[model samples]
Target: MSKNYVLSLYNKMGKLPFGKKLFSLFASNKAPYFKTVSPLITKVVPSECHCLIKKRRKVENHIGTVHVIAIANGLEMAMGFMAEASIPTHLRWIPKGMDLQYTAKAGSDIRCVALLENNQWQVGDLPVEVTAYDENDVVVVKGIIHLWVSEKPKK
Candidate 1:
């Protein structure tokens, strides 16, 4: 089974200056559409991934808070990191759907945290929950993401 590129990179460059930004740069190209949402990954580990999305013109809502859609994108980026590193190499997975609640206006740069307990992983479909918080530590968004999981085809 092949190693995950994203995890490989974090292992090699996770401590360097601007390393987190560099990782996100790579992700921007790998998933170009996500670039529009502009996620910046700050940290990652087997159990969790952290990300930030600044409130800027590209992602700001009419009232100047980060948009809910942009917050969703941040959640997705965090989840993608976990999925890339957590799924067994011989298994394949895809997002089936996601349910999110926008609980408050994201008044500052939003911090997103995606998590999956080591014990929750299994061989079939899985649901991973993620949350995004404002600078004040208030949860601005919450999500439950469903993913379809199965064995990889013989090589």
Candidate 2:
């Protein structure tokens, strides 16, 4: 798709209530990050995005703390949002790997925020490192996103 077309679509989609759902429709099964975040994401700003997921009673483990995997999931989703926003429509991206550390017990809501530099990025291979924090502002997880770009890759 043309850059102009994609940017225009994003602008239009941004106005809709279900703007985030648009990602699901396009990627569907491969869009797990979108599914995980769409419901909890409260806001998306220029160069940054904020997500919120409540610590439900059901989501807690035996110790009454939120599951470690749940927190990791939120971090990945937030990072994905940042990475996606950084790339152009002609490119594609995926989570290469992540290194996370669970500090304190998560008894309340978890928020993941991703920020990007406002400067323009030239279209090419890109990898973004995103860090997620708990309600107490302690780092809970970190991810290194590796994104591959190609007009066409060998199939």
Candidate 3:
């Protein structure tokens, strides 16, 4: 999909609590690969964010291991949600870059636990690293998310 199209969807999503649910349904219906590795934001608080993904055959690569792209997409999903949740209602956030390291093979379900050092998700221009782990608790990917912050109208 085009970046403009995706950003338009995201902007619309920022308006509703159940937006991700509806978006996921639409995405998974049209692109069933999403059904396998789509990450869902389960909970968010001031200090932490939780995301979950299911392992399924559809996301497996040629060797029956999880595709690297799929894992990255899941990581981005979690990071995006946490990035959105961490900032106040008066700010807009966009990812600038990502530094990733794949430490282990992903052969099972995955969960991304994004811990914020403070409630601050934005402080001008800076990058944050969010780590993801597999079901066995092994580090699978570390994403150093670079984000640009701007002010948005208060909700």
Candidate 4:
């Protein structure tokens, strides 16, 4: 069986509308909250998901910097994409929670690099490390995303 959906879609088509569509569908069907990430998850994985938030008035904080929640969303999306690319077909997973620290002022654009090591997700709570980098590649936000992984259900 094929291992990862993003990897399969990315193999047929590079990063673009279709890849984003499939990623959105995966989120839409499973967890609607992840749909918030559709526009930001521009790249495919197991390559790091380069999530971005434009410097729009809507996303800015009172100080005119990127809002903390926006960073959180992108960081979460990055971690999710990495998980989809790394997890085996025999396993099922869902994010359990996250612990984040905002270390710097985020820029107009943010990049998140989150990856799971081989065999990292067994059959329980797995804490995956995620960090969002500012334009300077300095970490603006860092966190551990906990995902509960289990054996896939029998059809």
User: lDDT of all predictions, in order shown?
Assistant: 0.84, 0.57, 0.66, 0.72
Residue pairs with colliding backbones in model 4 are none
Q: In lDDT terms, which candidate is top?
A: 1
TM-score of 3: 0.70
Q: Which ten residues in a row have the lowest lDDT in candidate 4?
A: 33-42
TM-score of 1: 0.92
- Misplaced by over 4 Å in model 3 are 1-36, 153-155
TM-score of each: 0.92, 0.63, 0.70, 0.80
**Residue pairs of candidate 2 with colliding backbone atoms:** none
Q: With candidate 3 superimposed using the best TM-score fit, by how many Å does residue 28's alpha carbon deviate from the native?
A: 7.8
lDDT of 3 by residue, 1-155 (tens): 12333334544764688876665555455545555676565555454655667677877888877777777666666556566545665667877887888888888877776665776656578576677788889988876767788888556
lDDT of 3 at 10: 45
In candidate 1, list every pair of residues with a backbone clash: none
lDDT of 2 by residue, 34-105 (tens): 454333554454445556667777557899876767776666666565555555555566555665656677
Ranking by TM-score: 1, 4, 3, 2
Best-matching candidate per TM-score: 1
lDDT (0-100) at residue 77 of candidate 1? 86
How would you encode candidate 4's per-residue C-alpha lDDT over 1-155 as one tens digit per residue?
66576777655554555765565566545657655444355565663566665666666789998888877877787777778877878888899889999899986577776767654668998888888887778888888888999999899
Report residue 60 deviation for candidate 2 (angstroms): 1.5
Off by over 4 Å in 1: 1-4
- Candidate rank order under lDDT: 1, 4, 3, 2
